[model samples]
Target: MSRQTSQKIAFALLTAAAVVVVVPIVLVIIYITIQGIGAINWEFLTAMPRNGMREGGILPAIVGTVVLTFGTAIVSIPLAIGAAIYLAEYARDTWLTRLIRLAIINLAGIPSVVYGLFGLGFFVLFLHLGTSLIAGSLTLGLMTLPIVISTAEEAIISVPQSFRVVSISLGGTRWQTIRHQVLPQALPGILTGIILGLERAAGETAPILFTVAAFYLPRLPRSPFDQSMALPYHLYVISTQVPGMSTEVQYGTALVLLALVLSMNVVAAILRSRFRRKRRW
Candidate 1:
């Protein structure tokens, strides 16, 4: 084949690959919307479940997922940011630092169910937190940390080295440079990481199952110490455990969960675009 023809063929293949990746996602959203749209209404969203979970709304599960996600952010963001700052700005290329990075990578690869077991044993039993909101939040936070730290460290490191040098030459202290120059510049990426981490936490079922998920609780949690129902676990229960469960309810729950995650992604994209527009570099 001529060189020009080969190039055209390669371009066509790349476009085909892109279509292959996107088609399934588009199909899934359309399928879920068709199957579940009838079940989505004000009453279904705002009221509590009734009739052995076959009727009424999933308000508690929705609230629980949101609350747990917020709590996970509280537990993870500070620690993740601190660790990322250390890794990016202060830590040297030493065996300890390498080991820490390796540990983070391994932690990210570990199965979510293992985190659930750890939360059950450590946070719930050993720490005496019980199978409550805090235990689940802690589990989800641990699960989320590796992603947040990796992205945040990358973000911090991506700031031009010259910027740091200029700040230092201006007589600014290391902490001041990081707090003002580095962090401000890196905030968009850090926020993206946080949103992605929290989005994953909000959707996971295994981590919350042993720590905080309520099997049939229809009421909203009153405090961080209380057990609550999350959408993932609820979906799992209704889809598998509940006999005679409505198909519409299952699809509706899935739709809501998908929408929640998509919403986070949309927000992340908007923030990233806005930040890029304002960026001087």
Candidate 2:
């Protein structure tokens, strides 16, 4: 075949591959929105949970999701940024750093249920925290830590060394250069990582199951120490708690969960794009 023909074939193949990924995602989103459209009413958002009722809202679950996700972000973002800074600025790509990186990757790869077991033993009994939001938040924080650290480290390290040199040439110290120049440049990427981390924390079920997700909590969370029901557990119950029972509610819960996570992902995408377009550094 001619070179032009081969190039066209390769281009077409790549395009096909992109479409293969996009099509299913599109269908899933469409399906969720359609199935969940009925579940998007004010009552659905405002009412309380009923264990065996035909109609009830997800107020506690919604609140629990927001609180846990935000709490996880608050807990993880600082530590992740600190670790990222240490990795990008101070830590060498030596055996220790490499080992740490591998451990983080392994943690990320471990099944969610395993994390649940760890949380149940350590956070619940060992610490005597019970199934509190604090425990769940911390569990999720650890789960998202690797993602945040790796992404932030990549962002920080991607800064041009010449910028650091320029700051140093101006008689700035290493800390000053990093704090003022490198960090500003890396903030967008770091924030993007944080957004993704929180997104992960929101959709997680297994860890929260053992940590904070209460079975029949009837009220909204009053504090981080409050035990509560959540979106993921609700979805699980709706799906498996009964067969041919409350399918609409099941689909509705699924839709709400899907929408919550999706909105987060869209926000992350927008933040990343916006930072890319208007980033000063």
Candidate with maximal lDDT: 1
Report clash pairs, candidate 1: none
Please, what is the TM-score per model?
Answer: 0.97, 0.94
**Candidate 2 — number of clashing residue pairs?**
0
The residue-by-residue lDDT of candidate 1 on 1-281, one tens digit each, is: 99999999999999999999999999999999999998999999999999989999999999999999999999999999999999999999999999999999999999999999999999999999998999999999999999999999999999999999999999999999999799989989999999989999999999999999999998999988899999999999999998999899999999999999999899889998898788778
Weakest lDDT window of 10 consecutive positions for candidate 2: 49-58
Off by over 4 Å in 2: 51-53
Best by the TM-score measure: 1
Which digits, one per residue and each the tens of the lDDT, describe model 2 over residues 208-236?
A: 99899976666898887789889998778
Candidate 1 stretches with Cα past 4 Å from truth are none
Q: Model 1 lDDT vs. the true structure?
A: 0.96
Q: Model-by-model lDDT, in order?
A: 0.96, 0.86
